[model samples]
Target: MIFLLSILTILNYNSNSIEINNAWVRPAGKGMNSALYFELKNSSANSDELFKVSSNAAELVQLHKTVNKNGLMEMKEIKSLKINGNQTIKFAPGGYHVMLIKLKKDLKTGNKIGFKFYFKKAGIIKADAVVKSY
Candidate 1:
């Protein structure tokens, strides 16, 4: 039946083609800066680029990379992060991460922060990152 076929298609599309796992944000004290880390997996046979990220808890959310410059660590804002088809990208400390700029409030452990990741091909993926104390 047409209805049955449509439902099946939708289910297949949502069946973890692109998934987020182990998402967490570092707890920041009074500082207005924070970082979020997660693992992104792309199971579909199409490459996608994460272009945008937004969060209500921060004034600005941007993709960033940590680079060592002159034996010093620096954070640089990047435009987008690419994830090839069937590839997994890890966003972790000392690597690629989401920079939460000008946080509205201090991040505390056991709290949840909502974020929306926009992909070029696969569309938008919403995730809640739990705040963790380091």
Candidate 2:
């Protein structure tokens, strides 16, 4: 029952709402840049766009994607990402990610970092991403 509940919690959101699930940040040394990965779900009837991401733990925050070009994997900044209604977008390794640059301090494993994400229609969402080695 607990597993079902957890799954439901991750999957379900009210109308015109957004939620983050399994949010995690990579562990890195002080002053080093790290990345965050998560699943963003939209349960709205209308499409939503992610415009900006911010965090106090890093000097700069950006949305990035790892693309394969000429057999080389390169990270590129993405200005915005649109999430269709009832869609779930995965920000995983080797794919779309949140880039946290110039860390204010070392992100130790098992710690949670707070972030504020701005959306075009959903407004600002505050999330806490856990730090992990993976």
| TM-score, one value per model | 0.85, 0.87
Q: What is the lDDT of candidate 2?
A: 0.91
Instruction: Please give the RMSD to the true structure for each candidate, in Å.
Output: 3.9, 8.5
Write down the lDDT of every candidate, Cα atoms only: 0.88, 0.91
- Candidate topping TM-score: 2
Residues 1-134, candidate 1, lDDT per residue (tens digit)?
Answer: 99999887566665358898999999986448899999999998767789888998888889999999999999899999888879999999998999998889888999999999998766888999999986
| TM accuracy, model 1 | 0.85
Candidate 2 Cα deviation (angstroms), residue 104: 0.3
TM-score of 2: 0.87
Clash-forming residue pairs, model 2: none
